[model samples]
Target chain A: MPGWYYDKKELRHSPSAQDGIDYKTEMRYRKEGARLIINTGSKMDLGYNTMATGVVYYHRFYMFHSFKQFPRYVTACCCLFLAGKVEETPKKCKDIIKTAKSLLTDQKFTTFGEDPKEEVMTLERILLQTIKFDLQVEHPYQYLLKYAKCLKGDKQKLQKMVQMAWTFVNDSLCTTLALQWEPEIIAVALMYLAGKLSKFEVVDWMGRNTKHCRWWDMFVEDVTMDLLEDICHQVLDLYSQSDAPIHPDSPPLHSNAKQQMPSLRPSNGQEKTLSPDRPPSVNAKGPPLSDVPQFPYQTFTGAPPPAAAYASVFPSSMAGPPGGPPPHLSGPPPHIAAPPPAVFSYVNHPPPFSTVVPPGAPPYFPANAPPPGQPPQHRPYYPPQ
Target chain B: MSFEKSHTYEALNRIGRGAYGTVYKAKDKKTGNDVALKRVCVPLSEDGIPMNTLREISLLRQLNTHDHPNIVRLLDVCHGQQMERELIMYLVFEHVEQDLSTYIERHSKGFSGVQIRSLSREILNGVDFLHSNRIVHRDLKPQNLLVTHDGHIKLADFGLAKTYDFEMKLTSVVVTLWYRAPEVLLGLTYATPVDIWSIGCIIVELYSLKPLFCGESDGDQLSKIFRVLGKPPESEWPEENISIKWNSFNVNSQISIDRICPNICETAYDLIMSMLTFNPKRRITALEALNHRFFLEEPINT
Candidate 1:
């Protein structure tokens, strides 16, 4: 089986770096992308495991392909969509897109293009191929819970420490720690950090002995202090910085777009200046927005142009009616125009939306027919992306 | 990490058809090795890949890390040409010549005592490895057991296997009815004990050359089991199985195993009885079955 881990040198020379994205700029894009996946998954009522898996998928996908090749937001949505099914919490593509639209500001939502569903569905195939269909991802949360059970300490303090460690693991998803280390090592290191921060020492664990001076020794052999602190510092770095600025030199969006692109990196010292105490943009919350220009409907055919060259690929007709039906719903793309294969036709037979039908209404409503008193309109048809 | 593309393997012949897709005997052009290419057609619906297929591939990949001898090897997974709306995925596996069912069918004469002992021991070893790894092969009929040219057994077709920790409320309808355990037939929750029940039925089939308790339906399967093993006392019947009443089974006396399969020795009979116990709690585990007296005793000539 192919492994997911990469060494420090391999990660430093990642595909994105090879595509002309500086390491710091690529890291900024990763943090924002991970945050998007976690936020989207939480809003959809998915568990932490599903969200972490999605983030891991995002990180791994960028390793094989450059961030310049694919838009971070679109890839984030596709990752979460695939993770939901892999984790056994299935959600419709339209529902996920709907939640994303509600969460994102109108400016950022433009990246989803005219048909958000088609964009995400199309990217799903590339995500699966890039990951090589190795769907199992072991996260640190399970190990943190398992190790906490073995420690003998004050119940409340232990619970608090474990909770802090769990949050650290969640934040660690933004970094490349997942690509660099196994879940066991990461779990042990985070638990040590939590214990130090909470002032709770594991003096009496289940298998405490003279040889096992440190609690982690009982779980994993030969864990050096240097390794644990290095892991802890990576997670701590997330809190030390307020936010990173988006690249200003990139092409500007439409004038009416609501999103406010922040000034370029402080080193550049060109373009509009950012206020020292400027209030954070609510449309794009969380980590500072990265410099990469968002490519809404850019196709991944051949060697994609670098991030600086993305202006040429931007669709000219992006300013469409906000919440109206898609312009091309009447004539879908030729590939999905045909009826779905009969193998899984039963799944499509039921009415698509669960919220539309009133209680005690007929269960066998024709998919094409609207409910009583409802106007006849095109219910958004989702063809295979 | 580049994967071997689908074009590298030349199709030789069609071997089998499954609910997922067809399996073909293919040859690697570069290495000159025979491989089994299982074609899985994934419908590109709103939901990208099927959940069951994802789980199956995930579980198999994890298990493949150990490289157990009795488990079939998943050599590679590569994408083929994408059809109009369906994606073709080929799971390349090490090919085996025959399955256990065909192997049993080819031997018109009864198997030697030594042959039966070796084959049964190999089967139990495979089951024990899976159980130790916290995986349950939900479907374990003869067709799923591949037989190599040298008569080695390699467990294959893990489409229904799952990695379980505690008592999971798994799908109620699993396993072929002929090899299904009573707990599954009665709709009661089950775990690894279900596999042991199937092994017990298989051990008897090794001697009788046919299924022990063959039935047409779930209820009929339980009836057939009761007729042979005799109905258990009301207290032993699981309280959770409300659909199956103790009185529904009219078996008044238990049939002797020797009458059903007289060719087996005394120790073999004892081992089979322990494996076919009515209660899953009392059913012989794979490890325990491996250490039974039948395996320890001298082989009796047929």
Candidate 2:
């Protein structure tokens, strides 16, 4: 059961190192993340394990090799690509390079000096090799397994906990927490939090249709702040830091910037569109299960995202030091701006109040999600600034 | 950019084209291991290799963890160079012969009882291992089953297999139209029993040189099944919500198995009949079928 996600180098490195958990290192991750966001000129949901993959890659890369050996820019790209692959939110190399070129437009592209594109591309390849081509990023599955095993005595409660935890892990991409903690810890924290709010705090509200009332009570006992604290402080945001450019020389493109990727570049309707129901290719069908081995997606929540722009969340946190500012720390946006960009705000371990699913009963979900009779938790949707 | 690691291999002829990549039979220069190198040599565009790469990745991950002389093992995954985004997944196995389909096509004229039994047991062994782990090989056609030089049968290509979590079950059209099961044909929520239908097809194919349930459409396909095995009682079919009418199969009037194979032992006929049952709840599970009299008296390798 020991997976490739378990990295020894990461365990020994500072910051990302097991004991390297602290305030300063966490803040740097956030700052660098903002640089990536500012570079992209758009905001990713930073949800699920997208940001987590970025941050975790940073934490892992810094373990064995230093900035001396691997430049931060290349390392940054590695983190992003690796994390993107893990979270199943794969981004193209062109976008990655564009981000790098723009973000470090001023830095004398130390690796490829003249052509920033080649440098970023080359760095991306190196990162792919470093990770041994294993893309089964960890997610809430691992954490839920542990939680499920702990609640094995109570199958009914465990089932509910697993589903809620799954929802948290599934949508963690919406928050910056995925950038910080491992999926296991995040899973534990999410189950703990959900158990507290809907399952426990409002037991009177949760109509116990079956004889599983006592099991619900014990769920509350299982939650611990010690665990919650790790999720809160360790899971970080990259944009909250100073690297995020709040003013956006030209305000960040509104949601309608039509930032269609090159591969997805819209057609001028000159050619007939292929049927959306076109069959999966024969030889190139679906997930190959034949000769070469692949990692199960169940363990996809491990690695963190590369650099991001959530640093604006900690506009002040990303500054060189406390009061003395270099002027870029204004803010990422308003609501999602709480956590910085570089910081690994993991999805498994979401922040306290950012409801991935609003605080009401959704028709699709049947958890402590109010009654079919009750109204669903309706919340306003805001595009990421 | 350093191509410092000059790894060489004596590339031989291409074995076959998978959904996403071209598989080559090759020899490693240093180790001399007969490696099945799958090369995803294509652009990253829509026309590129299909789910072949991912299918290989997903299937091999689990099969590699398993140790069965009959199961294909995935050794190493190599992503090399700029010519094309090629992924060379190295496997330590030899290309014995053409796949089962080729073998059946050329030699099914009159497969000796022993030969048929041996093929069945080997196929069953590999299938049983997969089922025990709750993995269903959605595609179990002769094309995906490989025969080793020593006459051992190895199951490969799990691209269409369904691994259900505690939440949902994927019951899509995973098998080739010929080998696809009946429920999947009816668009019902199937579990592992679909594999049983596939096994039945393989069983008939062993005797008949043709695909047993081969049909042009879903309706025709089910008609072929009803022709061989009478329709399931309405009470047995919980598919009242389904719209693919049973009459569409045009077999409310019963038909006979003699029309399909005409040549097979009574026991083998009975087994196939049970396997091709429309009700998945009634299909023979892998282990239960293994204990049948066919394997008990027929020639079977350990």
Candidate 1 stretches with Cα past 4 Å from truth are A149-161, A197-204, A240-385, B1-10, B18-20, B27-33, B66-69, B105-110, B128-139, B148-150, B161-201, B208-262, B273-292, B296-302
Which digits, one per residue and each the tens of the lDDT, describe model 1 over residues A8-99?
78888999999999987898789878877776776777777787899999999999999988888889998998899888887888888887
i-RMS for every candidate: 1.4, 5.3
| Candidate 2 chain B lDDT trough over 10 residues, lowest sum | B162-171
Chain B of candidate 2 versus the native chain B: what TM-score? 0.77
Candidate 2 residues A1-385, lDDT tens each?
2234333334334444344445444445434543453234234333434554565555444543444455566666656655565555666655665556654545434654576455555554455444444444556645554444444323333333344444444334333344455565676676654443223222232233464443333333443444463343223221122222433332122121111110111123222221112311122222222321111111111111211222232122221112221112222222432222222212222111222232453321122223333422321222123
Error of 1 at B59 (Å): 2.8
lDDT of 2 by residue, B185-282 (tens): 77878778988889988988887777877788887877767776777766666645787764554565665665566667777777877888777888
